[model samples]
Target chain A: MSAPDLADLIENLRRFADDRDWGRFHTPKNLAMALTGEVGELVAELQWLTPRESAAVMDDPEAGARVRAEIGDVMIYLTRLADVLGVDLIQAAQEKLADAALRYPAP
Target chain B: MSAPDLADLIENLRRFADDRDWGRFHTPKNLAMALTGEVGELVAELQWLTPRESAAVMDDPEAGARVRAEIGDVMIYLTRLADVLGVDLIQAAQEKLADAALRYPAP
Candidate 1:
């Protein structure tokens, strides 16, 4: 599949959520907390695996599918919450970097 | 000061970079590479600190200042990079969360 811009992907997902009538559940507080919970679940997938083993699971087809699903869930909530708050995730990230450069310009 | 929206924050930073004529240096490749470098530097700060020590440093005035500076740097560059590509950082993050929720769905 072609790599659609993330913005478009997000728009599509938002529509999906809205269709499911799930948008009502996506309050910023709930979405943010859910993001953390999903991260916890992702970490749980490799709780006791050796670093190498954990990495291995990332490549396993079934496990990879699950992981990818988890990742998609996280992204969906993040996009919904961010849209509600009117912040641009990528731009915010770059601003952080720019601030870093100014704070610690090449020494 | 009241927090301006992150979109505004990013726009302002972009202007700052443009003022410095540094936008030329922010090709996605360079920005992404620099982001990794800055993250490495931030990690280097507490490379060997005990978890407790690391936590302490987070609250220490001087170290906190430097850490915040590093974080700001990270945001600035991230914003700059995201803006160039026209992606919204917050929205992207939320999308990730939404995707995660669908993946895990309170299971």
Candidate 2:
């Protein structure tokens, strides 16, 4: 099946917040902070794993599911922050990549 | 300026990895683990902030820049992981939202 479009996801998130009267709480600053918190939680999941063990996390079905959900959390908050700030997530990412290409060009 | 397109970001990351011969180290599992580590770093930036304080992190220019960069790191790893696994990050995010809408419907 095809993947969902970023625009649609943003719209859905917008509606979700609006419906819950959450927009007032979703200012760019608030969302950014929330995004970091979610990222922290995601990291907490692997806090004690050795690099090799961390790398093998998905080998465990339960751990894998939790990891995916945390990823989903990160993405959700990220999208919300971008949307609130009028930043196009995709475009910003592309620009960052362009910058990276210059900073770390092919040998 | 328009934000980056997710697909383009993935392509750039793929090229970055191929150029550095980093693909051998970027399996989905490895990427997932690395993603978590980056998230950890992102979290460390705000570990001491109360929720109210956390919500205002971007008020400090230096702190804001650091936060944004960490976010960029998170996005880069996320894009790479999705690319490696043939998952469409945007689409998967949309699907996750669709599920969330049901799980946390409007009141």
Strongest candidate by lDDT = 2
Error of 1 at A59 (Å): 28
Model 2 residue A56 lDDT score? 70
Worst 10 residues of 2 chain B by lDDT: B1-10
RMSD of each: 11.4, 4.2
DockQ (Cα-based) for each candidate: 0.09, 0.32
* Model 2 pairs in collision: A4-B91, A90-B3, A90-B4, A90-B5, A91-B3, A91-B4, A92-B3, A92-B4
Q: For residue B14, what is the lDDT in candidate 1?
A: 76
Q: How does each model score on TM-score?
A: 0.50, 0.73
- Measured with C-alpha atoms, the lDDT of residue A96 in candidate 1 is 60
Docking class of 2: acceptable
TM-score: model 1, chain A: 0.77
Q: What is the C-alpha lDDT of each candidate?
A: 0.55, 0.71
Q: Model 1, B1-107: lDDT tens per residue?
A: 23455656766777666766776776544554454454445455555666446545545677655544444554555455456645555455555655655875642
Model 2, span A6-40: residue lDDT tens: 77788889888999898888755566567767666
